[model samples]
Target: MSFRPVIISLVVLALAGLALAFAPTGTTARPDQGDARPFQLRDTEGNLVTDTSLRGQVVLLYFGYTFCPDVCPTELGYVARVLRAMGDDVERTTPLFVTVDPERDTPELLKGYAPLFHPRIRALTGTPEELAAVFKTFGVTARKVPGAGSHYLMDHSSSITVLDRQGRVAATIGSTDTIARSVTTLRDILGKP
Candidate 1:
């Protein structure tokens, strides 16, 4: 009946309003240093990796997708070099590639892409809701923007979050951070001089 349709429309509008109210305002929300937000998402092999799984390891988590045009690859390349320079200390480090565009970057896609950039890096992804929650917890913002043809690209925060063994965010690597700075940051995390 007309009344039923009206009620459904009202309910939908209310839900939309609630969502907007709760959504992060702009990109001002930055992750505070040493805040370790627990998260659970599927890895490249489809295994669920949680905060507990990353315990006792230094984590270099970069949110990106394989299809990213520039920034993702550039940052990842620097990370690879830094990890390689870590020598044996790399054993205690975990580099993660978490996709902002999970719709196209499946576990299988990551399996093939992550290793190509760095042997030490692994990829992760999850349901849209799961991704949204994780992003919110980390103060990351990612939204799909229209691209060429039918394809689309994600506009997301390009910072790399460095988590120490305690899973606390130790450093935030900006998009323009030099490779030397990245290496220095990693060394600092590993207690190297």
Candidate 2:
């Protein structure tokens, strides 16, 4: 049993496992092309937003509450950095801050908080029903937990779901740990020749 042969066999097995685990699900075609899922939600101004409105743009959908003490802002800050890296490319992209705490985050509240991160970012909130539908559609979950007074913590999926030009979910950026990965993912998805 030569050590070289054993090592080579192990390496080949590992490579095969990696390939199977990461193989494209074919659920999302290349970012450059594909039919994306249609997404519709209300802007902070209460205007109805349709999926067609996001055409030819890379959209990052972040689900969090404005009252969030840290995670939300940190994630948004990373998004700001990514946008800055993009520079003019930001024109073709948008960061959307969708509120999980609609009770306290109204259209006006969102409007005030979102722009603090970036000029291109837009915040949105809607009725609980509307938010629930959107969350379900995107596979993000949000639940309210009891808290002090009228305040409560919302347990939501802390992942930034990236939507390609066609409004399909291209990838997910999880928590703050994936900021660098997100920047790379965005740059790669933007595909700026």
Candidate 3:
């Protein structure tokens, strides 16, 4: 049998391993935590949403485009479940969906897409430059992969960056994490239980 498939599988595994290695573990906060930089992007309603404006509220930030076929929808569904499980405690939290493909994911599209996952989930977008800075701040990497003519896909890191009431990087929940685990983490951050 040819080793081409084996080699490809090994390379894919290695890349996934590296991504996990560098990703933040959802655990107890360290003394050096709270390193997330400030960001400003426009919401679906054409209002500017900034880190400062969200102070005193726990933020669950996710980066994905509406055009994403599977991953984005799955992750957002997970977020919606977590929000539902939060019960009344959800009031103190904000879930944000920041699009990586601003060219395709316009305000009108986001306005419809975000509410489908959860009414509380606000979709944000900005200029390429603004998005680049936010990506750098969150250590998120998104690249365009050419597909069929005039079509492209984004290969991006998938993780939910949880910010504390003070707008600090409190924890990170991997896309593969269960809804139960996510609810528990958010509860811990919110000091609920």
Error of 3 at 53 (Å): 0.4
Off by over 4 Å in 3: 1-32
* Consecutive 10-residue window with the lowest summed lDDT within model 2: 24-33
Alpha-carbon RMSD to native, per candidate: 8.2, 8.8, 6.3
User: How would you encode candidate 2's per-residue C-alpha lDDT over 1-193 as one tens digit per residue?
Assistant: 6799999999999999999998633212323334566667899777987678877789888899987888899889878887887767788888899898988888888888998989889998777787777877676667788889977887766767788776777777645555567677887877832
TM-score of each: 0.80, 0.76, 0.81
Write candidate 1's Cα lDDT for 1-193 as tens digits. Answer: 7799999999999999999899755434555565567998888777898888998888998898888879998889878888887888889899998999988997887899888878889899988887888888777888899989999888788888888887777787754777678777887886821
In order of listing, the candidates' clash counts read 0, 0, 0
Model 3, 1-193: lDDT tens digits are: 6999999999999999999899753322332454545998989878889999998788999999998989999989888988999999899999999999999998999999999989999999997888988887787778899999999999887778889887788888755788889889898888821
- Candidate 2 TM-score, true structure as reference: 0.76
Of models 1 and 3, which has the larger TM-score? 3
Candidate 3, residue 121: the lDDT equals: 97
How far off is residue 190 in model 3, in Å? 1.1
**Model 1 stretches with alpha carbons more than 4 Å out:** 1-30
